[model samples]
Target chain A: MRGRARDGDEQRFLDITGEIGPELLRYFQRRIGSDAPDLVAEVMVTVWRKRALLPLEHEHARMWCFGIARNLLRNYSRGEQRRSELSRALRATVSVTDVELDSEEAVAIRDLIYQLGPDLAEVVTLTHWEGFSLAEIARLQGVPAATVRGRYRRARLALLAALSTDVAPTLL
Target chain B: MTQDKDHPAGTDRELGALLARGARPTTEATTEVRDQLAEMAAAIVSTNQARSRRRAGLISVIVAPILVLGVAGTAYAVTNIDWSQLWHNTPEWAEWAQDPDATVHYALPGGGTCELRLGEVVYSPDPNRPADVAADPRAEQAARDFLRTADLLTVADVDAMITAMRDKDENWAQADDGTAVPFGYGTDNYNADVEYNMAVKQAIQVAVTDHVESMGIPSTGLGFQSQEQCTGADQ
Candidate 1:
């Protein structure tokens, strides 16, 4: 019986990882840049430890994993002074500018998104980049859907204004 | 990049497209990440399986009989007594025991196991003290000291510590006598249990102080009760 339960847990973990692994990798890559793999491993370990609490529903499980990842990211940021040697090596080998952003426009847009502050930037990223609904983002973030919606709206306006300014100089 | 067909309404279509393009993963990178994920998942599964095996062995030896005794005790009480009297006679401490703040199980160095049931502001050590401790005074003091200083943050932490100890020695808590003690109490006998609990708690503190020169955690500060504290009037 215990073996069966263990098997079920392993299968569920693999299933979730298969579905959301790429997205999570991208998330960390975009946010923390080069240390994505180490953080991904940490998040996977947390997911395994808390596997019993994961919701049965697929979308809810995704959100729950993201919630864990968000907390892990917060802890990582807090104790960032103790970054691993591997992360530093990886950062040295691969520049975020070279690997992540394909074009100058995309790089500029990313910079603009970061300028909106972390909270608003996260809302914008989840909505546009990840294609999560405002309600789903709220669930993942432990916030109201209205709040996410408002932040996304504000982020869009900010991005549009920044883009317009960049284009204005060219037009003149 | 292909637009997300189910993109939410009111989002700027151009911005979403641009962000999606930026976020898109290369096939090679995605493959590498998936491989790494598979390896990590395997490691996690292996660790969990090892822990589960150790827990299963420990539970079969120690916990199974206690559970059976517990169930039998409840069953016998229910069948033998008038339901109303049983309900009426149940002390408030019984309810507190039902939802203890912490339950710690430890082994006696010589032989046998015991459980320390801690309430929010009280504690009850299982009546069945380890046989090894019963025979030797110094060993009993050492057991008491261990229990007093056992700092547990969560129930999971308690389980981990128990598992770790069990792994070191399978018969760490094996009792010489294989008899199970039934845990039940009527209203008249409830005070005796509370008194015994307080006495054991006090013994633990005294034992802890006598043994250690300088205590690190100050004997858990469990806010254990005195005889006066355990009363029907207080409840």
Candidate 2:
């Protein structure tokens, strides 16, 4: 009987792995680049260890994984170089499209987004890049949805203002 | 575009498109890595399960005897058992027991000491030994029996068993003087406990011996060697 329960837990954990494993990998990749795979494995092991605490709702479960990934990322960020160096490192390994990395417009826009400060930049990246809604980002960030929305507004206006002066002709 | 709660309007569709380009499309592990991850998960689950089983077994072994004794109106002794002496090596026992890990030792009903690490034997006195090999296989088996029937047995469990034995002993002494009529127990109850006490002690002796000597094949049933018998030697 205990064996059956354990088998069930193992299967459920694997199912969770299949569902969010990819997104978790990308979440790490976006932040830490090559270390993402190792971190993903670590997160899966941790999820299994703390499987009892996993939320039952599907969205919450997914967010639960992202939450773990986010915390791990924070720990990883400590004692590391700046995010730009990580971006450059990730960029080297990945093949990019003409607009993604090759184009001058893309580079200028990326730079402007980086200059938006970590809080604003994160809200924009989470919204645009990861495709999370403001509410979901709010949950992941453990802040109010309105706070995320405000940050998003601030980030967009800053990027728009910067684009208008320097890169507007090329980008617009 | 219509403004909605989820997506704010006029957030520059062009800018959104540009930012979206940087998003890495769904990272996937190779077939090899996925297989490895599954294997890792299995190992972790199996390891945890084994630990759980060992702990559960330990608890049952320790609790069952106490529960049985609780029924015999001998429950008062439950709180009196020195549980630490059963599970942990005391400084006094550490000097002669040889292994600091050994929490307690029992003298096999016949001969030899059964050194135990919490109801499990770590060392056993060997009757078959050439005086060179310190551990006796039968002694270990005796310990196993002692553990099994004795109920990972708390001192209370031993006390109950001893009480039964001593009650009979007192009756026998009185019977010798032709005075006392073994009160509260008929001949059967005393006989059962006496036989049980020996069977448990012998079984533990056999199990510990078989276990330590053979290292394979476990003996069935629980047995306990006489604690009083060994306590005398240790003190």
Candidate 3:
């Protein structure tokens, strides 16, 4: 019975890995560009380590994986200087055209999302990009729903201001 | 683009849609990266399984003996067993010998004694004592390097080396300085003897140096001396 349960857990882990593996790869690619492959390996290893504790529901498990990825990114960054260094490094290596942004407007929006700072940027990413609700993000982040809501609100305001300024020059 | 207090929802919905579209995944996972992730997952599962088996075995060993004993005997056994010793009683080689009173005095090559306690060189009667007798800053670092090398050797490799060294037919020669060196054993097959001898010697050197340094002793000129040799020298 114990062996069977363990086998079931392994299967569940593999199932989730297959489902989200490509999404996770792209997630890291968007953030770290060429370093994504290595980061994906790291994130998968962590997911395997926490397999026993992962939620049975697929949706919750996906969020749990993202939570681990977020922690890994924070650890990798270590400081604001390192974070900026990573951004600069990625920018140097990857062209805007290579990023597959649909249009110039899309590139501008993506750039503005990054300007919201790491904390607000993550909140916006989880909400819009990942399609996690504020409550789901709160649970993943171990914070209150209200905190995520406030962060998302602030991030949206920043994005709106940046967008308006970007268009104002053309209008003038 | 116009901001309205009552219709803040419109602005949020528009921005959210834009972000969602922009951040959508545009690339696929390469076959190589996927395969590497699969390999890592398998390795993690294997490791966890081994850990779980070890934990189960340990728990059974502890629990089975208590069950065999009567209730009163079990209680007595639990109370009598020194739980502290389980963690504190590490092998002398592995332990950081920090007890101040448990000092080991070594005879210098020239004359007089070098007193080592914990990691400190408390006293050295030798006139040629280094300026820093308290500790060799490099000793711990050297020991760490040795440990990293030692980690590569498996238990079977270490056991094979020991067995070969102990064999009478194995050419265990004594150098002019009286250090025992093993040779010719397991040499024809695998060069196991040479590898083992080097590894063991390095381990012993690191252990002795690390122990002395723990007591704040200058590990310069200090060599690996067994407790028996030091005791016999004292006599």
- How do the candidates score on chain B by TM-score? 0.26, 0.21, 0.20
lDDT of 3 by residue, A44-120 (tens): 55566445567877888888888767765654532212112112322333333245435565566667777888878
List where candidate 1 sits over 4 angstroms from the true fold. Answer: A1-4, A78-108, A166-172, B1-11, B17-32, B51-235
Q: What local lDDT does model 2 show for residue A117?
A: 87
Residue-level lDDT of model 1, residues B176-199, one tens digit each, is 243333222332223223223323
Residue-wise C-alpha lDDT for candidate 2, range B1-235, written one tens digit per residue: 1345466423557768767554434444555445545554554456456535643555333212210211122211222322223222344443323432224454544343444433323432223423322332344444444344322211122333343444454322133334443322354223333333333343334323322222222222223223322322211
lDDT (Cα, tens digit) per residue for candidate 3, span B1-235: 1223223333457766667655534454456445545554554466456545644554333211100101121111221332222112222532334332123344423242333323222221234543432234454343333233322221112343344344434433344455444433443222332333333433343344323332233344332222111111111
In order, candidate lDDTs are: 0.48, 0.48, 0.47
Model 3: what TM-score? 0.44
Range of the 10 consecutive residues with the lowest summed lDDT in candidate 1 chain B: B63-72
| Residue B150 in model 1: lDDT | 35
What are the chain A TM-scores of the candidates, in order? 0.75, 0.74, 0.71
DockQ of 3: 0.13
The better-scoring model by lDDT among 1 and 3 is 1
Best candidate, TM-score: 1
TM-score: model 2 vs. ground truth: 0.45
